[model samples]
Target: MISDTLIPDTSMTETNTDKDHIKATMKDAILKAAEKVFSDYGFEGASFRAISELCGAKRALILYHFKSKDALWKAVAEDVKTRFLTQFSAYYHEAELKTDLQKSRQLNVAFLKAARDVPEYGRIILHEGLTPNERIKWMSQELKPELVTMPDLQDPFLIEASLSGLIRHMQAGALLYLGSMGPLIAMDTEDADTLLSDASIEQFADYFQAITLARMDQLKQLEEMQKEQVEE
Candidate 1:
C-alpha cells in the first residue's frame, strides 16, 4: 500500500468548510473571467462590466461579491498567490536549490510546464507583478522561506522582480508567437511545433536559464568589484 503523506497531492476536498461552496464557485468564476479579461486588456483596461459580461453574471452581483474593481483585482491577486503555491511550490520543494543559477533554471522549467495550459496566468502575473505589486510581495514572503534556499539574493526584491519580468515576457511572447506562426514554422521543422510544444518550451527554459546564470555572474562580479573598491 502506498503512503498518503509521500504521495504528491493535488486534491481539494469539496467540503463546506470555510466558505460556502456556492460562494467559492462564484468567486472562482469571477476570478477566471477577470483573468481572461485582464490578460487581453491590462488592469487599467479591464473593468467589472467586462469581467461580469464574460462571466455571464450581473455586474451588480460582481460588485456585491467583491465590492469593487480594485477589490476584485486584490482577490485575483490572492487567487494567483494560491495558484502559484499549489502549482509550482512542490517542484521547488523537490529540487535542490544550492545556487541561484540552478534554482532559476529549475524554477523556469517548472513554471513553464505548470503554466502551459494556463497562459492567462502569465498575463495576470504581468499585469500586477511588473513592478512588484502586493501579490508578488506576498509571493516573495511565501516562496523565500521555502524555495529560496540561497543565503542572500542579489537584492532579494530586485531579483524577484527581474525573474518575474523575464518569466512573464517569455510566457506571453511564446504563446502569441506560436499561436500565430507555429504552424508555418513547424511545417518543415525537424522535431516538433514551435513555442507551445514541450520541446520548444524546454528550449525556452534553456535560453532563459543561460540568461539568468549570466545575470547572476554579472551581479557577483559587481559585488566583487565593490568589495575591492571598499578595501582600497
Candidate 2:
C-alpha cells in the first residue's frame, strides 16, 4: 500500500508570506535608523548596537538583514539614494524644460527637496567628502554614478576641469545650500517645493548652474573648434 501523501498547508503559506513582509519592514526600519546614526557618527563612528537601538530592532535581527556594519551603512546610503533618485526623476524628464539650464535648475530643486525629505542626506554627504575613502568612491562609482554628468568632451584636461567644477558648483552647492537656508523650509510645507525661495537660494542655485553651463558650453565650443581644424 502507498503511504499517505502529505497535504499542502495553506496556513503555512500565509505564515511564510507574513514572515517575508515582516523581514522587509524590519529592513526598511533598520535602514531608516542607520541613516541617522551614520550621518551623525560617520562610518567609523557608527555602531550596530546604536542602529538597532535607534530602530528599536534587535541587534541579531538587524544582522540577519544586513550581515556587517558596512553592509548596513551601504543599505542606508542606498535607501537615501533611492529617495533622491525618485525625486530627481521627476525633474529629469520635464516636458517644458527646453534648455540644459532649465533642466539643471529643476534637478537642483529636486536635490534640495531630497535633502529636506531626508535631512540626514546632507550630513552624510559632508562626511563622505571629508576624506578620500572607499565610501565616497563607492558612492561616486557605484551607488549613484549619474549623480555627476557633463556633455561630451575628449580632452583630458577639459574633462578634469569640468568634473572639478561640477563638484565645486553643483554637488558642493547642494550640501551648502541645504545647510544654510535649508533649515528654514518646513519639510511638510506646501511651498517647500516651489523651486525657488525668498531666502535668495534661487540666486545661489542659479549661479552654480550658470558656472556649470558655461563650462559645458565652453567644452562644446572646443569640440566645434577641433572639427573646424580638421576641415582646415
lDDT of 2 by residue, 1-232 (tens): 1111211222455576777776676677777778878888889888878876666677887888899888888888877777767765664554366654565565555565555566566677777778888898887665444543453345454466556666335666667556545546645455555534524555665666677667767778887999999999
Give model 1's TM-score versus the native structure: 0.57
Q: Give the RMSD in angstroms, all C-alphas superposed, for model 1.
A: 9.5
Where does candidate 1 stray beyond 4 Å? 1-21, 93-101, 128-193, 212-232
Number of the top lDDT candidate:
2
Least accurate stretch of 10 residues (summed lDDT) in model 2?
A: 1-10
Best by TM-score: 2
lDDT of each prediction vs. the true structure?
0.61, 0.65
Encode model 1's per-residue lDDT on 1-232: one tens digit a residue: 1122322222565555534655666666777787678766767778777876666667887888888887877677566556754666665557777765566666666666555655555566555556745566754554333332322345553375455565455545654544335546667574344456667767887987676556667777878999999999
